[model samples]
Target: MAESSPVRFGILGCANIARKVSRAIALAPNATISAVGSRSIEKATAYAQENGYPSTTKIYGSYEAVLDDPEVDAVYVPLPTSLHVKWAVLAAQKKKHVLLEKPVALNVKELDVILEECESNGVQYMDATMWMHHPRTAKMKEFLSDSQRFGQLKSVHSTFAYLGDTEFLENNIRVKSDLDALGALGDAGWYSIRAILWTTDYELPKTVTALRDPEFNEAGVILSCGASLSWKDGRVATFYCSFLANMAMDIVASGSKGNLRVHDFVIPFKENVAPFYTVEDSWFGELAKSIHPAPSEQQVNTDLPQEALMVTEFSNLVGSIKGEGSKPEKRWPTISRKTQLVVDAVKASIEKGFEPVEIIY
Candidate 1:
């Protein structure tokens, strides 16, 4: 509640996502990792130690214990999609601000309840969507809004896919039976929806439909589904997501005058190839060059730390909460609305045998 105070963040899980976010929280200004909770105390303590966090950061055996700590000013929930709503509401009820990861919940109904709880508690509630906070997306939005580059926006097509490990498959929470609906749609595919909604000012279609292959791994939990989202203005966007395959994770936007193609749009600049963009007069004018991998100068394997964009953004939200006026509240209404709409549409399509369903927003 104090204006000049640094916000204390207590993470709810020690999953891989948590490691990346924790690093981000450490880098962001005026944010501190006061505590971290995991299902195992040893795991929590080890994570805290390995990550260079203060030893004073208490390790809790349960998430609820972290929420109950008076020192924790805000909570970050990176649990499975179905569990998001339950823990979010509980955090709000405890009077803690929340930065929940994507999908927020499995459906609109769950999200509505979480939103209601936040409103009732008078606490800040945000979906932890780093793409929305990235500068590249802002540039994309600018180009999409310009009349010359984007007049009468016609279509948006996106693909988000990656391969999963079998060993990880053995112990991962993602493969659990209790979290049936928390798959690629709720995970990576949510990025496609976020992109279209944010770039198009949340003008989406009334109907949506999906086709999926159920034989895959994460696909079994949440299928690799593609959807055709039809807008009221006759503008349609196509979306694709998969956890069983590897894709470039590209997002292409087509309009009347010109088109924009972004490869690795979701994790753009996070790793691998440098996150730099070069604008060209035409997309087809580009040539692909294949270079053979040169042998390493040293016969040693190197490790690069993971990206913490989510945690950095969450910390910024905390700083905003302590700031005079936060713009995320006034500006993020469209994000919240569109997220629910896209999620609802996708779930409906999956449940009805990939039938075309209408979006209420």
Candidate 2:
């Protein structure tokens, strides 16, 4: 990378989600999409053309070509979970910073392999959890951390679901056992698990118990599932994820002194501003004397969307390592691994007759 140049990104596999991240990379001040690769040259070329990729962008027929390109500084991989460990590790081994999609791997063991590769190669690794980069997320956390208002956490409930029509259920890769084996638990539940972890300040729960009513598809892949996580302090969190229900992504956290509610924690209804509600100590005995209603605490505003912010943040990290000789940031991969650990525990609980599975980590 030359002085004052943007971090050039090479996109691998051209998944549908790549379109969103591609636009984000183009919009970010410190990032640019240098190349896009797929299994076929026609698809790569046509995708770049149809998606409005810059004329300067290179098109490659194979993922290996993108990784071999000397002009590319980093890669954004939106491949299926099954392919995550392979491509992510390869990207790191090639000395390319990796911005991997959510549900980083099928298990913690796979994630550790990817993380080790990045560490050994001295490359940055970040999971593409766009909401974490949002300005609203930080604002919401501030309230939860405030002792005067939120005090101590008691319980949290999270829900993420969307109706999958006839076409998606029968044909989508997520429904395939070999592609996204965790299905709804991995796709939608990952967000809920992350939200619970964030609310608890990244504390690993003592145990995880599946809700005992998980629905599976014909291929034995999960379509709907829920899990309960409990901590030693008696703090409990429950999350529901599904592909059979209407669109709903919500979080309700009740603490000793106050409560917090977010209607859309995964993706806000509006792109520019996100709102969260909070209520503190209040008393009620009569009809209007004791009952207190929480109002929107803040409408967090941002100049760019969360995905663009994510791209910018990742680019800056890559730039620091390339320009300032800074070591790779360890915070991101560490969180990603912790998130995967909980995911694995949830899967185990579901497999073992929905019994409570202790979280060793």
Candidate 3:
């Protein structure tokens, strides 16, 4: 690959989420769609055409064909969770950087195998947690880190949910046991868990306790769930995710000196700007009748959507490895693994009759 050329991406599936990611690849200044592949060549072709992929983009009938393409520098994998380990490992083994969708694997054991392959093959690995690339997220981190204003973190809460229609509940891959079996936990809770981990600077929680019984479909896929996480220092966090609630994405973090809140944590309400609220040293009035000051709202603007930024960042890392002879970035895979570990712990807690599961890592 030339240093000045955009990173060439090979999409491994025609999953619906891949449509959005294909646009992100095209929008990213450092990346371009090189190929799209699926079990059906017609579907792959249609996906490429419908997504406005460049005319030069190749369509392949099988994922292996995309992997074997010498021009492809990276792969965007949007396959279901059950298929992630197999395709992701193969992509890495083929010397292609991997931009995998969330719930990277069925469990930590599977994720470890994928990571091991990427590590051995020296290919960059990043999950499609687009919001992490948002400038608003960075701004929120700055506030959380401010000792004088935000002070020491005390607790955090996150929620992500969207009411699913009848068709979705009956036939969506998310509700299928053989597909995204982790269900709503893997779909929506992934973001909530990631948010909690991010606020704590990637620190592993001491324990996880699933809240009560998780609602599941007939196929045994989770449809709604919540969990509580605790740290040795008494810092605590809670999160809820569902496919049966009104759409909502929120995160609230309280600290000794201040508090922070974001209603749109997974995807911003608007593509151009994102807003969050915070209040420092909130206190009662002299008469103890009311709070002293209102929370201040802050907005962060971006020219490109967060998903595009995610692609740009991942492509830059791939370019560094391909063009500049740099080592794969460990930060991304580390954070991804941490997030998965927490997710696995929560699931374990739920399976153990809501007993607190101690996190080892």
Candidate 4:
């Protein structure tokens, strides 16, 4: 990667989620999308032209070419969930900082390999669990940690679901490929666990029980799942993830004095939907809409994509690397390890007729 003025980014693939994050990257204060790579040169060139990028913003016919490009300082890997670790290690080996799509890897072993590769190559890497960087999530963490308010929380309940995407379903990437490393567990459950762990800072669970629909093939890709978590600290969380359901996302925290519920836990709306010009605005208003509003310390509300926040945070981490900010911590490893524990527990439970499996982390 060349040392340009601002950080230059090359996208590994033109996946749809990559488009969503490309917008975020464009909005990022310190990043630039210098190139996009696609298996098809025509697709890459078309994406470059349609996205209003400079023609010099190279459109490579192969991912490896993009990695070899001198102008690309970082790469966003939005490839299939199965290929996350494979390409992430390659990107790091190419000396490119990576912002990888979630579930970081299919399993604990793959995640470890990716992390080890990044460390050996001295490249920064982050799983794209953007919401943890959101203001609301941080505030929720503070509120949960407050001994006076919500002390020693008993349980966390959360859900994330959506109607299956037409193309994704027909092609059945969710059910067919090795890249389909997980079903709802990898897709939505990751966020539910994120909300629970990030908010409460609980030790990873000791046990998990999961049930899935038989037709889903891989136990990970289920129409719906119900799982129970027993954390090491005696705290518990119950979470659900589904692909057959309409978008109904929620997270609830029950503590000693009061309870807090996050409606639309995944995507909080900032601006109300408009007739013709529906802008994707901030989520503050929606987040604050029906707060219980505790007397002494108020509940918090903010709507921001986790990706944007995560990117900003990563940028700060990079600056810190250059002695421009506080040193970054090994947060990604912790997050990856805990998330994989949850994933493994769920898979084990489903395989064993919903038998409870102890959480190793």
Off by over 4 Å in 2: 1-3, 285-290
* Tens-place lDDT digits, model 2, residues 124-203: 99999999999999998999999999999999999999999999999898888888888999999999999999999899
Candidate that beats the other on TM-score, 1 or 3, i.e. the better one: 3
Tell me the spans in candidate 1 whose CA falls farther than 4 Å from its real position: 1-3, 168-171, 212-220, 269-313, 320-334
CA shift of 190, model 2, Å: 0.4
TM-score pick, better of 2 and 3: 3
Worst-scoring 10-residue span by lDDT in model 3? 1-10
What order do candidates take by TM-score, descending? Answer: 3, 2, 4, 1
The candidate maximizing TM-score is 3
lDDT tens string, model 1, 1-361?
2235667899998767777778767765556789999889998888889888877898998889999999997888888776887789999899777878776777777887888887677667777776565555566677678786466677888888776677645555555546636566777778887877765787667888876643346336664667888777867888787766776577777777656667767765445232423232333323635323321121111122223444555556656755655533534535775777887787777778888887775
RMSD of each: 6.3, 1.5, 1.2, 6.8
Best by lDDT: 3
lDDT of 4 at 196: 71
TM-score of 4: 0.84
Candidate 4 stretches greater than 4 Å from native = 1-4, 54-56, 165-168, 212-220, 232-234, 271-305, 322-328
The lDDT per prediction is 0.70, 0.92, 0.94, 0.70
lDDT of 4 by residue, 1-361 (tens): 1142456789988777777777777666666788888999999888777667655688899998989998787888888878887788888898887788876777777888888888777677777876666666666666667766566687789888887876756565555546665777788888887777765564677678785443364344555676888766767788888777788668777776545567665765542210111111123345677533332323344343556666666655554554443433478767767887788778778879888998765
